[model samples]
Target chain A: MKKLINLQPSKPVRVLLGLLPFIILLLLYIGASDARLADNPNDKLLPSLNSFVEAIDRMAFTADKRSGGYLFWQDSYSSLKRLFTGVGISAALALSLGVLMGAIPFFRAKLSPLVTAISLIPPMAILPILFIIFGLGEFSKVVLIVIGIAPFITRDVLQRVQEIPSEQIIKAQTLGANTWQIILRVILPQIMPRLLAAVRLSLGAAWLFLIAAEAIAATDGLGYRIFLVRRYLSMDVILPYVAWITLLAFIIDYLIRLASAKLYPWFHSQEN
Target chain B: MSYLNIQNLWKEYGDQIVLEQINNKVEKGDFVTIVGASGCGKTTFLKMLLGTETPSRGQILLDGQPIASEPNEERGIVFQRYSVFPHMTVLENVMLSRELESSPILGRLFGKQKKQAAEDAKQMIELVGLSHALNKYPHELSGGMQQRLALAQSLIKKPRILLLDEPFGALDPGIRTDMHQLVLKLWKEHQLTIFMITHDIKEGFFLGTRLWVFDKDRFDPQAPNAYGAKITYDLPVGDIDKETYQQIDQSLTPSEPEIAEAS
Candidate 1:
């Protein structure tokens, strides 16, 4: 029975399986929302229907700006780039500090309590201080995020490093490994799984902070656009941006997990 | 002078004494096994030999010189479950020890000597009957196989003394016997001096050319009287037969709490 469950889906089977959800959801939404359809159905649907088909046609052919859909695409692309860069910078800073704190015992002991204290202070509490310090710029937003995300990363990784079996370190030492060798070969491999998990968790926190940071402190990001739409009560625009963020987060998390499984096949087998 | 000698060795933990007046000698290529019930300080004896722990009373001399304060390349140790690096392949683990001992800065950067050490590691793996598992991680291998890899890594450095702390306690009886034979074969071929600690009487009797038993006061017959006391046995192993081993097992009464036996 376990063996049967482990069998990989064929290409066509996987494709069909992937499409099955969208198909089901599409049918459900159409069926469920159809009852509330407006009496002037043509008036409500005709322009959007025509615009959707035209947008698809334009996308299929060229970069022609027919009906200002080009503006939406451009804004989304720039927003995506900004979001990913923001996430990457914060994650990188967090991971570096995390690994550094995790590997050094004295640093871990001395710094961890301060980190815990800082992490408990609400992220929302930091905006005014950040604005006062960095004066309402990108620096304030990025710095706010780095401060918010790095402690969780450090705490998770420090705990993980401590949890690695002491036997592994002793084994390497008996084999004549130096401190650096032990870290690179033995400690790093053991912590990679924990590190990956920490990153996956922090990615969500970082995203939350990013939107909050952008919405309050700056402009020209998805968070700002969402906040702007909310002001006008533009639920459609707001909902779509939320959907995009959710989809992107899901994709990034999935990709990282896939990479982890590939790099550490031993973990996946144990997971079963 | 003996190849390895301890001079009036004494070990104590604060007010409690662990080992008192331990004086022993091991010749070149000798297989010495220490056997005792739990908490007999057999492990402490090995730790002193490895220089991992200190004896408060005396000094250890290897090759007629005092052993240093830290562990060195001359003593290779095999732990119970953690002898091999779990993440690295068998080949990588074996080669890494050699690289640590020999590689220079430029050689390490270029990985030149490491490459050569890898080939040598492959040869050692073949010697240990694990060539097929050269690329497998420790977790992917069986317990017996992992122990075999541990042996390979220990031997790869060609250390003068091989210290084992009940390395086969986790293996089944049959696999344990196989590992014993494999270890003896490698030891004989390399003329390696072995100091192993085990609680298994059969294993102690079977492997050691000379067996020393630790009779701690806790496990000894008379607790209050035998407190801070010990008895050592030097059982000669020469042309021993199965019946003789059985006789040795049957003749002795172990120290039970209420029943005190004289040494």
Candidate 2:
């Protein structure tokens, strides 16, 4: 008899095993939803599958009478725009500042403490101040996301840069590389994959900051729409919106991971 | 003047002395192997020679000029690990020094220069017996192959001085023997001045034209840091008997019962 810990599954069995929990959850949800609808056809607490499809159609397919635009698509566009912009700026800042701080002792001594202190602050605590200063505009929302994640990414990148063996740096010096040359050739390529990884880790926090900012200040966005529909007790609409947001986040995470693995096979190999 | 001169060199970190009162002159093509117990400042001595760690006192002169305070193209080093850039393929690893030197700001070469550098790097890779792995990254190469790649990376620069810090300390015995032959062939072919530090006394004897033993002649029971190591034995390596080898080996081994038991 094989021991449980030592037992291994074949490829098809592994795939089926991965899907087991989701399948169980789906069946359970369908049974509860059917029972609730039988008891009260108008029950919004556990809406039927038909109700979900109807809500999605109303939000996505129907054009708003006031603005002549699809609310779902518009909200998605605004949210994604803010998310990418904030994360992009943060990535750029992390690459430059992090590499400088990690590679040069002078910069490290000067900036590392400041970065550590900044990263320690709760970003949400400063949301009110950001609203006061930037006046609840898109800029403030974007700035909120940047301030939320930039310090963390910068610190992560700094650690990765510091983790690079000193021998590589010394070897570069002996190869006649000046400081600028070393940064460009030796440090930048190595730091880039690490930067991607940092960004991926920070995406969850980035999204949280984005939704919070949008909920507090924005007239249009995924978070705004969800909050707007809350007053009507629109569980059908809210559930789908939440699922859509989760799906989007999953796709973005997947894409970033795929890009990293594709571009830096060497890094992935070292990791394994 | 000697090809290289170390005059009254001393390296200290605060009050703790690492290396003290080191003085020697090395010819252009001399292969000097150094052996010492762990933490006896053998690496510190090598770092000083490579111009990474400056001596607290005295000076080192190469061909009648003081060696630069920082590492330069005139000196190359291969550490036990991380001697090759992980991100680069074998060819790129060997060609990087040339690219950085020629282009300076961009750290890249183009057109005619790029072609010439690739050619030179390929030849160097061939010399190190890594031609088949030209496109392979450091992670993909075996330990011995990676060290070979590291050698190619350093030798591509054609440095005046080559420093090896326990370059084969982590290899299998069979691979180490193969590497020893490769290093000897490269040394003669390049006519290079080399300084190698090893934990293995046998390796020191087999590879070096001259061997240096770093040990302190004085010890204080109250304060261990009161003294530092110096070149206690500098011998020309012509023929060494088994008894002499055993004596040096016994002397270098630490007198700790725990270490002996662990080994």
Candidate 3:
């Protein structure tokens, strides 16, 4: 036999490469199942298949009026919208607090004990406290996210501010930059990439927290829906919802990475 | 009176003495370069002058007045690294000092108020041959270009004296030569007093109107005020076009036996 050539797919040719494995698996699966289908003694399979197709077709056609309840994927959109609101608020509050703490050493020092205490206890531990304070509403969810995310953001920005090259600060002083100029101009730019990285990391944390928050006290989120499926042992619904969550998280993470790469190309160079 | 004088200068880090009983005088518009081996406190001395660091003993008198701590705007300094702000464009870096001088109040208002400052920045950018990249960020430039941007930032301040700490040491040989020539041209054009430190002996000889050979052993790390690793000798490098004078001075310069005793 002639020697076989093993070809590695490159980035540009990845689509074609990806299809190869799928096609092979599909053919093998169909070939193996073909005998089983013919061997089946049930003409009753027609009724079940008809019911499955009918349900799918009805949902596909009437998806608009039902508020997309039948389409699990459409329900995920509402969940996503709610998650976005939670995340946006969390990020803004955390970023503001982070910048404030990072900029003022006195404030950071004064708040050190309290911040340490709060951050040491995971937000999940204080579910009862959040329930008491904000109730089992959106307020509780937002509080859960902010508490989970703020300390990490503050520490990240603080470290970045501290790690800013002293030479740059000294140089700015020599150039006659006042304290404010040094902070706003020289120090700010240096810390921005790290701060952004912290925000991206916080977003992922917030996403996880949102699910946890919904699980603690909520009726309508992806996590809630997943919980509902588990109670009924409906793995079909659970499986699709799980896949949807995974895909959504992947897209969010990818978008964040893309933003980071665009904003901070120097980070890639630093890795090497 | 000397334009600036370093009399009985001393510096120490904890128990270690880096500079001790050093005396030197510089005239207005003179280009002075100090060269030494590594860890010889060349940068330490420059920092002391810039008031970034304090001398353990002794005083520096500028224009016959003793300098107290750091002056607001009398001296400009450039460093080996491109200390230009990566966020700001080249023009902004050069105009910073002028902005400080002209708009003491405008800065409070966050107003960009220096028409003359902008003009001066443009001229300095052109002087550095960076007219085309005036609006570019420091990170956009090559290392040499960034250093030139840094140089422009320093010179535009128009301080009575310029202090450079091995500003061109980071450049390649060809770019170093170019920078050396550029420094000469800028010195001549501006008639600015320049004091610089460098490890390159030839570079010292090329630009320095007067060069100081800092003796190595004199820097006593244990002493409270060490004079930079025991500068074993001092040589008054003669003026340019005086190679024969340098030869004569070299012979007159203390021999090893005398240097050891003095050190």
Which candidate's TM-score is highest? 2
Give candidate 2's error at residue A10 in angstroms: 3.1
Weakest ten-residue segment in model 3 chain B by summed lDDT: B218-227
Which parts of model 3 are misplaced by more than 4 Å? A1-8, A18-120, A257-272, B63-73, B95-119, B216-236, B239-263
Best by DockQ: 2
Model 2 regions lying over 4 Å from their true place? B241-246, B255-263
lDDT at A192 for candidate 1?
78
Candidate rank order under DockQ: 2, 1, 3
DockQ of prediction 2: 0.88
- Say which prediction, candidate 1 or candidate 3, comes out ahead on DockQ: 1
Q: On residues B218-238, what C-alpha lDDT tens digit does candidate 1 reach at each position?
A: 433333333442436666766
- Provide i-RMS per model in Å: 2.9, 0.7, 3.6
For all predicted structures, in order, the TM-scores are: 0.82, 0.96, 0.77
lDDT of 2 by residue, A111-158 (tens): 999999999999999999999998988999988989999999999989
Instruction: Identify the runs in model 1 with alpha carbons over 4 angstroms from their true place.
Output: A1-104, B102-112, B217-231, B239-255, B258-263
Calculate model 2's interface RMSD in Å.
Answer: 0.7
Predicted candidate 1 versus true structure: per-residue lDDT over A1-272, tens digit per residue: 45986999899999999999999976775554454355444332222333344544444344646554443465466555655665667556655566666777777778777888988988778789888988977677676666777677767877777766665666666667666766767676777776777778888777787788778855567787778757756544555567777988999899999999999876666567
lDDT of 2 by residue, B1-263 (tens): 99999999998998898889999999999999999989889999998888888999999999999999888889999999999999999999999998998897799999999999999999999999999989999999999999999898888888999999999999999999999999999999999999999999989999979999998778665566788899988888878777877877876987454354569
Q: Is candidate 1 or candidate 3 better by lDDT?
A: 1
lDDT per residue as tens, model 3, B172-252: 998988898889999999998998888777777778687766654433334324335433334455544566435534533
- Pick by lDDT: which candidate is best? 2
lDDT of model 2 at position A195: 91
Q: What are the clashing pairs of model 1? A: none
All-Cα superposition RMSD per candidate: 5.2, 2.1, 6.2
